[model samples]
Target: MTVSHLFMQNYTGPLMIALQYNDLFDLDSISTSTDTDALPNGRAFTFIKAVQTVNERLVEQNKSDCLLFEVILISKECSEEIKMKVDESVKHYGLEIGKFFFCKKEELINTLQSNKVKLFLSTERDDVYEALHTGIPAALLYDQADDHVLNQLKVIFSGDVIGFSEDSLDGLSEFGFSETQIETIKTAKICMKEFAVLIGQMRRRFGQENSPLCTCVLTSWGSRNVCASALKTLREWGLDVDEAFCLAGAPCSPILAVVKPHILWDGGLLNMS
Candidate 1:
């Protein structure tokens, strides 16, 4: 049997999200210091809180299952004490949605596959790229110190091709645009579809008008036809966004500033700063 076939056999059960443990918690600090009051990374804490809220909403809607959040430590340097501290911190922060696995960097991919990880998140760009290249949806988590919106889980996606398949936007970019524009739109779609499903579930469970999950789409496509085609495709796929912006060739920073999404899935195209 083919390798792809073998891989598919392990893709079972609820949507599993594999997060690099270091991305969510400060391993270096935990290992070297004995401070018991150290907190989880600010951004990581907010992300986990948002997901836990999502799970609560799912339960309210009578859903039996919740999205699984798995923490993976891809390192060989951690001591047993460090692992114990990390576990304590996870429970203390109420972020223990799933179990933790410690493995070497080389064993990361196999570990993820065996766990049926539908999405993999890491602070390392190389790791995210590797996961995407291996057909696993992945995103790079950026560290920010500013306070995020705590009441809601906000997510933003780049519309052109970030969350969409390249073939979906094929023949729509015939406009006389520069090479840069074409390249930006042709960037990887990665995990947009998976995120859409997540957002959709949140919206359904919490009611669209009162949903705690806010979603937006930001696209660089300025032409009306292109924007319309993209929106049409989203609708056909049963994906809906609360807001959308079409910035012809403008920098996405301004929109990002206002949205302040906990997660921005842009297929590694735009700067997350």
Candidate 2:
């Protein structure tokens, strides 16, 4: 099935995002520190706040029922002490309860699948890769020290294959820019489209002017024909990105520096390493 078809099939349901508990909390610090004032990870709190802001906007517009946003924190192992610390952190951060779970590392994938997670986030590259391989949209979380927090949640998507798999690009070298290749790229099934659909629904319900979310498409397809085709595909899929940059063969660091997206779904194409 094409990415568009997958998106159309699941866009109406709630967007369940599963985040690694270790990514959000400095477990080591909480466990080792003698100080009683340790705080949760700033980046994690910012992301949570951004999502909450969107949910608030949706409620204000009376569209919360149309698109539900849910977040779950998954921890590989949790002791009572750690759980108590985490609970304190959640309350300290002014977050809601009932969002944390303790599961074995071996059962993480099953947990995500059973919960029908639309996105998975982790600080470990291997964990993100594992989730991607399991056909779940996942991204590596990066720590940002900057104190400035944007009320709007910014998400970036790469136009190429949206997951870790590169098999979808196998024919590109053979066909080059031929019509067959262009059509293949246009119709290729990708994981990011599911995220696109979620963002699209948010944009539609919250209104572009007042929405708490911003989305961008950063692609290497700079040629007019390829870029047009990719964007046309997005439009047909009901995803209208707020910004798009055609980098051709240029480095993406410059653009990423400016965008500073809270989450990026590049499927390893952007060399985020």
Candidate number of the best TM-score:
2
Listed in order, each prediction's TM-score against the native is 0.77, 0.81
RMSD of 1: 5.9
Locate the minimum summed-lDDT window of 10 residues in model 2.
Answer: 180-189
Candidate achieving the largest lDDT: 2
User: For residues 174-248, what per-residue lDDT tens digits would candidate 2 score against the true structure?
Assistant: 535454333333333455566676767667766668568887777763444445555676776777878878776
**Candidate 1 Cα lDDT to native:** 0.61
What is the C-alpha local distance difference test score of each model?
0.61, 0.67
Point out where model 2 deviates above 4 Å. 1-12, 31-38, 63-66, 142-145, 162-168, 171-189, 221-224
C-alpha positional error of residue 53 in candidate 1 after TM-score superposition, expressed in Å: 1.0
RMSD of each: 5.9, 5.2
